[model samples]
Target: MKKWKIILLLAGVAVVALQITNPARTNPPVLHDLAATNPPPAEITALLRAACYDCHSHETKWPWYARIAPSSWLVVSDVNEGREHFNFSEWPTDPELVVKRLDRINEVLDYKEMPPKKYTLLHPEARLTEAQRKFIMDWADAAGKKTEATAPPK
Candidate 1:
């Protein structure tokens, strides 16, 4: 029984290690028309670059810890999902896409989701303070308004 249990535990560990080692997101992220419209303000961009850009942008700045297993899998999964939802790296050039991005950003902020719990756990810096959250929320709102693409033309 003891041997059997040991073997099972080892097998599980192996599987977990394998899953972690196999990165889930590897594509080089891109930024589109970001400079033309919705160019991140220097301060906000710095904040985001330090905090949210890793998983949420095409320009993911990999840390040494990323190479480690377990964490690597989690990180890869997050980057993959983040990109799927809203990739700051791939800012949209089209007005419609820009509107969509703003909507999505608003959704993430209002829901108090995004920069998922797992991400914040490993990446303490990414944790949003009330002030920072408010700043980002305001940024989203203003950008959305500037885009002036809200509401369908009846």
Candidate 2:
């Protein structure tokens, strides 16, 4: 029993020390915000804000669990990956890039692969209704069409 207690105490100390290595999960100043550049319909904006912004934009609302050690590392890593794939904060003004992003958004939504299950489990608001998913997909398709129309031919 005494040996077990010592082992547990050392494990606890190691966990505490691990917190110091937590990655920085910050919301830096947004330069070219998507909403500011080309605003979407209000409902679409709201849906995106509730369901996608946490990981996809600079407006991430870090929850308390995100500040802890192991979870913090996972949260930060996910956020970084999310931003790398699609960041509405630094949304491209280039029409080709916009079309590409719109297509990717539609693809992800159609596959029901966004707002990863782990994320929605903790953040119910991030879960999209079927209607919301349709609206987002329709919007993406329409936006992609518009971008393509305006795109200069190579």
Candidate 3:
């Protein structure tokens, strides 16, 4: 019993020490938010904001767990990776690029590969119903076609 108590105390100290190395969580200024530049319909916009913004945009609403250690690392890493792949807050202005991004969004939605399970497990509000997913996918397809029409000929 005394040995177990010592082990627990050491584990607690290690966790506390790990907090000192927590990565910085930042919400940089929104230089070109997707909605501001090329607005989606109100419902689509709301869906995106709720289901996609935290990780995919610069408008992250850092949760309480994001301030802790190991979980913070995972949260910060996911946000960084998500933004790196496709940032709604730093949307591309080029028509072709915009079309490409929209297509990618549609593909992910079609595959049911977004608002990843890990994220939705924690942020239940980010979970999309089949109808919501279809709505966003349809919007993405329409947006891609619209942008493609405006893209310059290769």
Query: Which one wins on TM-score?
Result: 3
| Residue 5 shift from truth in candidate 1, angstroms | 17
lDDT of 1 by residue, 1-154 (tens): 6999999999888966675456644757364635556886887777677677887777887776566676676667777887787777678766677877878877787788876786688778888887887787788778878777554554
Task: Sort the predicted structures by lDDT, highest score first.
Answer: 3, 2, 1
Model 3 ranges with Cα > 4 A deviation: 151-154
- Backbone clashes for every candidate come to 3, 0, 0
Q: Which residue window of length 10 is worst by lDDT in model 1? A: 27-36
Which digits, one per residue and each the tens of the lDDT, describe model 2 over residues 61-130? 9988788899899999999889888899998888888888888889998999997899899999889988
Q: Which stretches of candidate 2 lie above 4 Å from their native place?
A: 1-8, 151-154
TM agreement with the true structure for every prediction? 0.73, 0.90, 0.92
State the displacement of the C-alpha of residue 32, model 2, in Å, after optimal TM-score superposition. 1.2
Q: For residues 54-133, what per-residue lDDT tens digits would candidate 3 score against the true structure?
A: 99999999999999999999999999999999999999888877888888988898899998999899889989999999
**Best-matching candidate per lDDT:** 3
